[model samples]
Target: MLSKRRLTGTISNYRFYAQSLATASNSLLGELNDWETDGDLTTKIGKSLAAIITSLDALQHFKAEMKRSPLMPKRRNADAA
Candidate 1:
């Protein structure tokens, strides 16, 4: 089992990768528009990229909530006393 810090780091890394991929996807879409061809393919690829970005966003949010949860020992607030 990974430590809490390691787990959090892994999630953060994934979030960063997703963000980068989204930027690349947007760039590709822009190039497609400039070429003024294959609009249908561009739309399909755009939807796929959007879905990936949305999913990753949700995952990052869930990871944040997990870190804040009372059940996570490492994240427990000292002020809780």
Candidate 2:
């Protein structure tokens, strides 16, 4: 029993979270790259890489859900905005 507005709000929040996750993953990957270059791949760096992989999986799932949801359009172009 969710109102349309609330549901849309939920989706918007999820999208925002997904974007944040992507940003975080990118940042982590950058750190990982730096670690690799320095040859200091410690346990913490490995853990961060693992976390990035997990987040990427979750991002794919959320992206698929967003595509399937009625609230999302099939295609969105930046120039269209």
Candidate 3:
């Protein structure tokens, strides 16, 4: 069985990865918006954007679930420090 500290570290890494992916997706969408395209290409871009948005939504849900998991460490309040 994994130690609590190790397990927490792994979960933290996963959360970081998810955040990185979301940031990258947002950057890609911004770049895509700056591009000028024809009707066919526009349709393809729309589909791609939809897929990216769906993936981001799923990641957000997963993060929320992780926050609710008992194994995850509780966050400290900065003001209480």
Candidate 4:
């Protein structure tokens, strides 16, 4: 029974998290490329990539849930009244 505002806030938060995950994923990939010769560091970067992919999946699931929920109403003119 989440309120519209709460639901919207949840979606917004997830969106931010998704963006952060994407950024981290890109950074990790770059690091992996640079450290490919270092086996240990490259392995760690690969693990980080997997973690970020999982996070992105979770965020997408949250977004889908929000889309299925009947929370946000249709847009209305501010001065219609």
TM-score for each predicted model, relative to the true structure: 0.44, 0.47, 0.50, 0.61
Model 3 TM-score (2 dp)? 0.50
* lDDT for model 4: 0.76
Best by lDDT: 4
Per-residue lDDT tens digits of candidate 4, residues 1-81?
A: 457887878878887878878887887877768784765786678777887888778787886776567774555789997
Q: In angstroms, give how far residue 76 of model 3 lies from its true place.
A: 2.6
Cα lDDT of model 2 by residue, 1-81, tens digit: 335685577667667767766776676677777874765557656766676666667667666766667665567788989
RMSD of each: 5.2, 6.7, 5.6, 5.5
Question: What overall lDDT goes with each candidate model?
Answer: 0.68, 0.66, 0.66, 0.76
User: Which tens-of-lDDT digit does each residue in 1-81 have in candidate 3?
Assistant: 345686577567666666766766676676577677544656556666665666667667667766776776799999999
Best by TM-score: 4
For model 3, name the residue pairs that clash: none
lDDT for 53 in candidate 4 is 82
Number of the candidate with higher TM-score, 2 or 3: 3
Model 1, C-alpha of 1: deviation from truth (Å): 24
TM-score of 2: 0.47
Q: What ranges in model 3 sit over 4 Å off?
A: 1-39, 78-81
Candidate 4 deviant stretches above 4 angstroms: 36-39, 72-81
**Which window of 10 residues has the lowest lDDT sum in candidate 3?**
37-46
